[model samples]
Target: METLEGAELCFPQLLNTSCRKPLQHHAETIFLYILLSCISLLTVVLNLLVIISISHFRQLHTSTNLLLLSLAVADFLVGLLLMPLQILLIGGCWFLESFMCGLFYYASFILTSASVGNMVLISVDRYVAICDPLCYPTKVTQKRVQISICLCWVCSVLYNGVILNAFLKHPDRYNTCYGECVVVIGFITGAVDVILTFIGPIAVIILLYMKVFVVAVSQARAMRSHIAAVTLQGSVSVTAKKSERKAARTLGVVVVMFLICFCPYFYPSLVGQDMSTSVAFSIFGVWLLYCNSCLNPVIYAFFYPWFRKSIKLIVTLQILQPDSCYAHIL
Candidate 1:
C-alpha cells in the first residue's frame, strides 16, 4: 500500500493489508462494528421510547423531559444515520462524492456538538431547579426550554459547518473511490470543534454541577433546619425531598458518564499538539468517544427505575398483545 502524510495516518493503514494478522482481523472488526451499530441503535431506540412514552403519557411531560426528548432524537439520528457511515469511514471507505462526503461528516459533527451542548443545558437547568426551587418554574418555562434546545442545535450546526467548508476545498476533490481528505486543516478546525464539543460544554457542566452539588448539600441542611416545619407539613415535604434526591442521583450519573467518555478527546485538543498515538489508537479513541452515545440508555436502565418501568411496560403492552388486541389497548 502507498502512504500519504507523515507517519500519523500511516499507522492505521499499516495494519490493514500489509500485515498477516491485521488482514485477518478486518472481517472480525467489521462484524464487531455491526454489533456496535446495533447496540448504539438499541440505545437510541430506547431513549426514543422513553421520549415517546413520556410524551404520550402527558403526566410525565415536563421541560426536563422535553430537553431529554431533544437529546434522544439527536442521539437516535446519530445512531441511525451516522454510526454506520462512521464504521465505513473507519474501514477506509469514503463511499460518496466530495460534497456528499462533506455533508455527511459535517452532519455527524454538528449533531454530536448539539448533543453535548444540550447536556450542558440540562445540567444547568437541573441546578436551577434544585438550588432555587421557588424560582424554578418561572425561570425555566416551557418556551425558554424549547428556545434553548433550538439554540443548541443552531450553534452546533454553525460551528461544524465552518470546519466542513475549511476542509472541503481540495483541488483533486473528485468523484473517486480513493478517499482522500485534507486532514491537516482538520487538525486546527477539529481543535476548535473539540473545544466547542467538549471543553466549553464540559466546563459549563462541571461548574453548573458543582453548584448543583452544593445546592443539594444546602437543601439537605435546610431540611434538617426545618424539621419542625416539616413535622407540621406532614408527608408532602418528605415526598418532595425524595424526588429531589432522585433527580440529583440521575444528574450525578450523567456527569460521571460525561467525564469518563469525553475526557480522552478533550485534553489532546486543548494542548495544541498533534496526536502522537498510533492510527489504531486514534480510530479506537474516536469510537470510544462515541460510545458515550450508546451508554445513555444503559445508564438510564441502571439509574432510573422509571425509565426501565416505562420500557418494560411498553414492550409488554406492544409485543405481549397481538395486533388484533392492540386497538383495544390503545
Candidate 2:
C-alpha cells in the first residue's frame, strides 16, 4: 500500500508533503504536449509576422494598424511565454520557484487585460471611422493612437497588480503540498475581475460596434439613394464610404471571434466561483483563451490583402532591401 501510494506522489521522497501526480494515460500525455507545442509555435510565428509587417511598412502605419500592433504584442507574449509555461504545468507539477510563479501570473494578467483594452480601442476606432468619417483623420491620428495604446498597457499592469496583490505578496500561501502551483482569487475579487476584464469591456465593444453597424447601414442607404451634381466628387464619396464599410466588416469578425474565445474562459466567474488555475475546466478555458492568439493572424491573412502582401515580402526577404519600409503595400 505504501509503495502504491508513493507511485502516485509527484515527489516520493517528500512523502506526506508531496502532491499526487495526476493520472493520465502515457499516450494522452504525449498528444497534449504535441498539440500544445504546435499551437505555441504557430501563435508565435504568425503574430511575429503581423509585428514585422506593420513595423516595416510605413504604409501600414495608420491609426488602426497601431492598435493591431499592440494586440499582436500581447498575443506574441502569450505564445512566447504563457503557452510554454502552461504546457509545463499541464504535467501537474510546477518545478519553478515561488517568485517565478508570481511573475508568471502577473505577466499573464497584464497581457490578457491589455489585449481586451486593445480590442476596445479597435472598436472605438471603427466606430469613429464609420460614424464620423470626416472627423476620423483628426480624431484618430497616429500620435493619439500611440498614446492610447501606451495608456492601455499601463492601466492593465496597474489594475492586475491590484487584483492579484494577495497572491503576489505570498505566492505559496494557499499551497497544500510541494509540486503544486495554484492561484485562487477570492469570490469578491474574482467577481470584480470578471466585471472589469470581461463584462465591462465586452459591453463597451458590443455597444460601439452596434452603433458602427447602424451608422454604416444608414450611410450605405444614403449612398445608394442620393444623386450628386458632380461626378468626380460623388465617386470619391462612394469610395470612402465603401472603404469604411469594409473596415467595419473585417473588425466585426475579429470582435465576434474574441467573444467566442473569451466567454468560456470567464464562465466560472459568471457562475459565481472564484477563479482558479488548477481545475481541469479552468485549464481548458485557459488554453481556449490562448488559442485566440493563434487565430487572430489567420483572420488577418484571410481578410486583409495588405497582410498577405506583407507576408510575401517578408518571406522572400524583400523587406531587407533598401527603402523597403516605403514599399507600397496597400
Candidate 3:
C-alpha cells in the first residue's frame, strides 16, 4: 500500500507535500502526447518558414511584411518554448523550479500581448493602404513601421511585467502542493487586462476592418464601372487599388480568426471572474489561444502567393544560391 501510494505522488520522497498524479488512461496519455507533439512541430515549422521567407527575400521586405515577421517571431517562440512546456504539463506536474515557473508565465504573457499588438498594427496598416492609398507610402514608411514593432514588443514586456508583478515576485504563492504551477490574477487586474489586451484591440481591429470593407466595395464598383474607359495610367491605378483591396480582404480573415481564438481565453474576465490558470476551462482556453500561432502562417500560405512561392524556394533549397535575397517573390 505504501509503495502504491508513493508511486502516485509527483515527488515520492516528499509524499505529504507532493501533488498526486492525475488519473489518466495510459492510451489516452499517449494519444494526447502524439497529437500535441504534432501540433507543436507543425507550429514551429510553419512559423519558421514565414520568418525565413520575409527575412530572406528583399522583395518581401515591405512595411506590411515587417508586421508579419514580428508576428511570426512571437508565434515561433510559442511553439519552441511554450508548447513543449505545456505538453509536459499534461501529466499535471511542474518539474522545474518556482522561478522557472514565473519566467514561463512571464514569457507567455509577453508573447500574447505582443501578438495582440501586432494584429492591431496590421489592421491599421491595412486601413491606411486601402482607405488612404495615395498617402500610404509616405505615411507608413519602413522606418516608422520598425519603430512601431519595437514599441509593440517593449510595451508588451512592460505591460505584462506590471500585471504579473506579484506573481513574478513569488511564483509559488498560489500553489496548493509541491508539484503544481499556477497563477491567479485578482478580478480587477484580470478585468483591466481583458479590456486592454483583448477587448480594446479587438474593437479597433473590427472598426478598421469595417471601414476598409466599405471602402474596398466602393473601389471595386468604381473599377468595374471605369473598366471600359481605362487608359494605361488609369489601368495602373486600378491595379494598385485591386492589390490593396485584396490585402485588406486577406488580413480581414486573419483578424476574424484571431477573434475566434482569443474570445474564449477572455471569457472568464468578461464574466467578471478572476483569471486562474488552475481552472480546466482556462487551460482549454490557453491551448486554443496558442493554437492561433499555428494558424497564422497557414493563413498566409493560403492567401498570399508570395508566401507559397517563397516556401517552394526554401523547400527546394534554392534560397541557398548566391544573391537569392534579390529573387523576385512578388
- Winner on lDDT (1 vs 2): 2
Error in Å for residue 154 of model 3: 0.2
Residue-by-residue lDDT tens digits, candidate 1, 1-330: 644332233134544322122232667777877787786677568767766666655445678878777877777776777666666555544545556666666676687788788788888788877776657778999999999999888888877667666555652243222453213334676577677678778888888888888877766786778752534323336567657767766867876876787677555666776533233643566566667777766777787676766676677765344442223211
In the range 1-330, model 2's lDDT, one tens digit per residue, is 446464777777888888778878999899999999999999999999999999999999999999999999999999999999999788888888888888988998899899999999999999989877768888999999999999999999999999889899999887888878888888888898999999999999999999998988887787688843335423447777898799889989989999999898889899998778874864679998999999999999999999999999999999999999999998
> What's each prediction's clash count?
0, 0, 0
Against the hidden true structure, what lDDT does model 3 obtain?
0.90
Q: By summed lDDT, which 10 consecutive residues of candidate 3 come out lowest?
A: 227-236
For model 3, residues 173-196, the per-residue Cα lDDT tens digits are 999999899888889899899999
In angstroms, the error of model 1 at 205 is: 1.0
Off by over 4 Å in 3: 1-7, 227-236
Error of 1 at 268 (Å): 3.5
**What is the Cα-based TM-score of model 3?**
0.95
User: What TM-score number comes out for model 1?
Assistant: 0.78
Error of 1 at 131 (Å): 0.8
**Rank by lDDT (best first):** 3, 2, 1
